[model samples]
Target: MPAFPRHVSRKNEYRILSAMLLLLHLAVWWDFGSSKSRSLLLAHAGVFLIWQPFWRLEKRFGLKDTVLFSLVSIGLACWIFFCWFVVLIGLMSGFPGYRRSGRLVYMPILFFLVSDLLIGCVPHIFHVKALPPAVTTMFQYGLLAVPAWVFIVRPHPGGGASLYSVDLLRAISASMMTGMLAVASIAITYHLGVDYPVALFQSLLGLALFLFIISWLLSPRMGFIGLAQLWERSLMNIGTPFEQWLAELAKLADQQQSPEQFFEVSFN
Candidate 1:
C-alpha cells in the first residue's frame, strides 16, 4: 500500500521552527489593544497550531475519507476557545445512532430549535433584549456547526469503516485543555490588572505555543507501519540464530537422539 513519506529534512524542520519563533515574537509585540489585531493574531496562531498539525496527522494516519480536515480543525479550534454551545451541539449530534436514516435530517432541526429557544425564548422570559449577546454568540457558532459535522461523521480511511475515534478523542482532549488553560490565564491576568484584550492575546498565544511543543514531543518517532514491523521482529520472533537452534533441536528429536546427543546439540 502506498503511504505518504514521513521524510522531513532537518533543514526544513529548522526553517519551520525558526519561522514559528519569529511569528511568536511578532505576535508578542502586536497591538493587542486593538480587537482587529488580536483577532488576526489568534487566527494566525490557530492556523499554525491547530490546522497544520491536524493536516499532518490526517496525512500521516490516513484517517479520513474527505479532504475536510482543515475545515474541521479550524471549526473545532474556534468552538473550543470561543463557542461552548457549538461543542454541546456537536456532542448531541455525534452519537452513534444519530446517523441512521431519518435521524440525520432531524439533528440540525433539533440544534436550531434548542439554539432558538436559548437565544430567543429564555431571554424573553427574563425580559431581556430579544437578541442578546449570548444569542449572537450562538448564532455565530451555529454557522461553525456546518463544518464540524464533517469531522464527527466521516468514516475511517483505513480498512476499518468507522469513525476515527482515537483522532477525535485526541483532538477533543487537546481542545478542552487549551480552552481551560486559556480561561485560567485570562482570569489570572484579569486579577493581576492586565487589560482584557492584552490578557486574552497573551493567554491564547501562550496556549498555542505550549500545544505546539507538546505535539512536537509526542509525535511518533517512526512511521506507523515501520513501528509495527519493528514490534513484530523484536517481539513476535526471537531471532535468526534462535530459529536455527530450534531447527537443530527439532532435527535431533526427529532422529531419536539420546539424551547425551540432545545435550551436545543444545550446547553446541
Candidate 2:
C-alpha cells in the first residue's frame, strides 16, 4: 500500500478514538436508564465495532466475532453498565490494539481507564465522596478541549502526528509522578497531621519547584549536556548516535550494489 501522510492516516483513528472516549465518559457519568441509556449503550457498542483491533481493518468479521458482538451488544443494551461495564472495558482494553499505538494516542485512553477504576469502580467498594467540582470539571472539559485543540486549532505536520513526539521515559515518569504526588498529599493529610486542603497546597508548591528544576534541566546553560538535547538527539538527523548511523550505513550497503550507488543513496 502507498504511504499516506500521518495526519491523513490518523485523522479517522482520532475521531473513532474520541467517540469511544466520549461515550465511555458519558456512560460513566450519567445515571442508569437515563437518556435512554439503553440506546447510549447500543451506540457505544457500535463504535467499538470499528474501534476494536481484533481483525484486519478492511476485513469482514467472522461468524464467531459477529455472534459475540451481537450477544454483547444485546446484553449491554439491557441496562448493564457503570462499574461492571467499566470492568468489561478494562478487560477489552487489553486487546493489544491501542496499547501498541503511539504514546500520545494512548495516554488519554489510559487516563480514562484509570478514571473509571478510581472514580467509577472504587466508590462502589469504599466510601468516597464526589470529586471536587473543579477536579471533575477539569477531567470532563479538559478531555474535549484537548481533542478540539489538536484537531481544529493545532497544525500537524504531514510527517508527524503531533507538534512534538513524547519520549516513553518522560511519559512514564509523568504518570508515576502524578500518582505519587496524589498519594503523598493524601498520606500527609491523614497520617502526618494536616488538613487535606493544606496538604494539597503544599503539593502544589512542591510541583512548582519541580517545574523550575525541569525548566533548568531542559536548557541548563552550564556546559553540561542538557536533558532536552539528549532527548532530542534521537530525533534530529545530525546528532544521532554512531550506532544508529552505522546501522543505516549497513542497510544502505546491502541495498546498493556499488560504492558510488551507496554514497548516492546515503546522501539522499
Candidate number of the best TM-score:
2
List the global CA lDDT of all models. Answer: 0.42, 0.55
Q: What residue runs in model 2 are displaced by over 4 Å at the alpha carbon?
A: 1-11, 32-35, 62-64, 77-101, 124-128, 146-268
Candidate 1 segments whose C-alpha is farther than 4 A from its true place: 1-168, 220-268
Write candidate 1's Cα lDDT for 1-268 as tens digits: 1233323321133233233323322332233224543454355454343223224422543345334545554444322324433343333343334235224432553444344333422332333333445645556455344334422443322311122132354335544654464455447554776644456457667778987765555456633555545545655565656787788888877775588777776676
Alpha carbon lDDT of residue 43, candidate 2?
A: 78
What TM-score goes with each of the models?
0.27, 0.42
Minimum summed lDDT over a 10-residue window in model 2 is located at 154-163
Error of 1 at 64 (Å): 40
